[model samples]
Target: MAERYGVVPTRRQRLPLVLGVLVSLVLLAWLLWAAWSHSTPAVAGGLTSYDVVSSHQVRVVVDVSRQDGDPVTCTVSAQAEDHVVVGEDDVTFPAGPARTVQTTMTLRTEREATSVAVTDCRAGSGGPGARAPGR
Candidate 1:
């Protein structure tokens, strides 16, 4: 009788090994997804900024907050007719989930105000509060 040089894997042994590897991969992927989803925070509540144009004065309303923390110091800027009308303000708040800051400034230009723009609005770290980072 010829002796087998190497041992061959039986069908039962091969199936269990293949199935075990596939199941482990699937479980690892699910765990990674769950961790990522929980770390990120969603923009809860109504946080928005708008420029209100009127006859005498132009008003800028800035609303910003974190998901679970005190109100962040948001820097606000306003412009009229391509000129820097409002500079910037570092507004802080007490310990809470979120906060809103509203600032208003009067324009002293003789020319009729055509348009108003608000930019450089930021929170948490400090950035130009201009329409967020990547839209």
Candidate 2:
């Protein structure tokens, strides 16, 4: 191998290095901004509590936070002991002058469910996954 210990990089070599560094910085900044925006999303939801009311029903309380004017829909599900969905449905929070909402609803199940939870929540029934809704 040739010794490169005393060799100075030419302008051509330094140009590519500088360009690569600039491109890397820009890409990193964009990535950070994207992550920060997504972390705070447009809406978020969580399940505060649930009740196995009967052999065919489960009552769940969902708490959601979002922009005051945009209506959001959340999917809630009841699962059997085997982790199979016994009941699932979409709950739409109507647009109003509130950023946070706590809703309680009962899901009629095919059989007794071992657990109930809010699966996914979004601004509209469109995107495959917006970010969050339910924890």
TM-score of 2: 0.81
Clashes of each: 4, 1
Candidate 2 per-residue lDDT, tens place, 65-132, comes to 98756878888889999999999877777677799988888778999999888888788643443223
Error of 2 at 98 (Å): 0.3
TM-score of each: 0.35, 0.81
Pairs clashing in candidate 1?
120-128, 120-129, 120-130, 121-129
Following a full C-alpha superposition, what root-mean-square deviation does model 2 have from the true structure? 5.6
Q: How accurate is candidate 1 locally (lDDT)?
A: 0.46
- Candidate 1 residues lying further than 4 Å off, grouped into runs, are 1-57, 83-86, 98-135
- Candidate 1 lDDT by residue in tens digits, 19-98: 99999999999999999976664322222444445543444444544555643444444445657353433333334554
Mark the regions of model 2 whose C-alpha exceeds 4 Å error after superposition.
1-10, 125-135
Residue 52 CA displacement from its true place in model 2, Å: 1.5
